[model samples]
Target: MSSQNADVVLVHGAWADGSGWAKVIAPLAAEGFSVTAAPLPLTSFADDVAALERALERKTGPVVLVGHAYAGAVIAAVRSEKVKALVYVAALAPDEGETVADVFYRGEPHPQAPKLEPDSHGLIYLPPDAFPTAFAQNAKADALAVLAASQRPISPASITVPVGRPLWKDRPAWYLIAEEDRMIRVDNQRYMATRMKAEQRSIPADHMPMVTSPAAIVDIIRDAAAAI
Candidate 1:
């Protein structure tokens, strides 16, 4: 399908919601791509996949599914035929039988990366300071404020589960590596991208490039959409 004819779905990772993709949405839409940010419940892996599938069901044409950070695994779990391509932005791509944690912790984390732990309710939250310090270290103070304020706690069940065969194995995939990412180390991003055999684009942005480097993210997604 032509770029304009295909649909684009943006999925946010843990500690984030659809609004995290605000900068990305407009430019893609302006390029004539019908774009929607799919919201994950952050409750469980299965719930996130089901939620993404529901979003796919509502789309009218081929889709370029884009995922950031933790949502990478969520997007890969969907078995949708409408997903014509996969675009991972500093995202994970765990192989069959591997858990998200396996890949996320494959390499050393940036020193400033937060120490995450589940709260009494069993939900893992990104420490507020982590937003400015690691998650989006390159983002401005205003952007950091929005991210911290809108952050959603992710359930432990979301990352601990083993994933089946990933959709990236069957579909064309592109990876955008966040070189300065503190949350997911740059080497981990390279490793995952290489393992998935994805076309890689390196950006000198932090973990949250959709906020700090939207133009680069938009360009890569546009490339993926056009290729499809």
Candidate 2:
């Protein structure tokens, strides 16, 4: 498919900003496709969806909305006709009436996730110790340190708000399972992929595949874009 036919929008997960997609953006853009790395507020589900919707409105042609981790929940909430397909990258593909927290705690607890505490505003922030193992397990120490220092505080409300609609149920979906993920277990990802009826690919990477396996992730998005 021609580059003009598809616009790839990358949505970041919680505890992260748009820079989370920095490693993968160039390669996808190098393929001659228009791309946008959406910087989500990570505040509330509704706010994040609204932010994504605003970004979607900027695209001139059909879009492939790619969500990573918590942003998967965000993308699922924003069901835009302009979005031709949905791609989940080690993302939380929650079902209707489900929330990200529900999916995470339903399964066994992740050892790496630090004990999260809500602030006066009810926003949850990942403690520094959890960053290395939970988020950037494959990244260099220096890079991981930078990420940990800059981690965004997630609004607690996003975890409890049930998804109104799941885009994967209607839109063609693609899922990339990070086999070595420590935060979201591989089994959970597999279950979600199956439930979404998504075309699946597995990579032996950590939670952040876009950082460690950008080419593979980009290829999946490309295939999904072509199929759509």
Candidate 3:
């Protein structure tokens, strides 16, 4: 598929909305590629997948779906045949029967993720103190504060639910590894990338590479777009 015929849909992770892709959107748009940042409901796997499929249905041509953190699971659940490629940005790339929580707490202890306690309504919100170090370690002070303030609580049930099908199994994939990511370890990222047989690129950044290194992230996305 030609770059002109490809739509790049960016998917944001937990505790964040689609606005998190603000830095990368204009650059991709400038490259003459139509881009849409899918605003995930973060309530459940089904809702998130439905929202992404709705976005995919709007696209007129081939798609390059980029998922960051928890959004990877959402993208995997989408059945849209329009998706021609997948880009994982420090994201959770789960397998056929894997869940986000299962992938995260699979082996070793995650020292970075605090023990989150959900509210009576089953919403899991990160504490204020964990934001600067875990979510946006590479971001500037002002940006980190904004991210923390804008953080939305995710549904606890979304974590353990398994994905029915993973697009990475069929679609070409590229993994952008953030070496300094505290939220998701570098080892786990490598494991997922290897599992997906993705083309890997390492960048010295934190969890939110689109914020800290938007240019680099755009370049990777451009390469993925070119591949399509």
Instruction: Name the best candidate (by TM-score).
Output: 1
Candidate 3's residue-wise lDDT over 60-139, tens digit each? 88899999999888887888889999999998988878789988765664577667778888899888878776777778
Residue pairs with clashing backbones, model 1: none
lDDT of each: 0.92, 0.86, 0.86
Candidate 3 lands at a TM-score of: 0.95
TM-scores for all candidates: the values are 0.98, 0.95, 0.95
Question: What lDDT tens digits, residue by residue, belong to model 2 across residues 1-228?
Answer: 435579999998888887778778888878888989998888788888999999999888899999999988888888689988999999998898888888866688567756777988788888777777777788888778777877898888778888877888889999999998888889999999999999999999988888778888888988988887
Query: What is the number of residue pairs that collide in model 2?
Result: 0
Residue 189's lDDT within candidate 2 is 93
Ranking by lDDT: 1, 3, 2
**Residue 68 error, candidate 3, Å:** 0.3
lDDT value, candidate 3, whole model: 0.86
Evaluation by TM-score, superior candidate among 1 and 3: 1
Error at 221, model 3, angstroms: 0.8
lDDT of 1 by residue, 26-141 (tens): 99888788899999998999998999999999998999999999989988999988999999999988999999999988877778989989999999988887887898989999
Residue 29 local lDDT, model 2: 78
Candidate 1, position 4, lDDT: 92
In order of listing, the candidates' clash counts read: 0, 0, 0
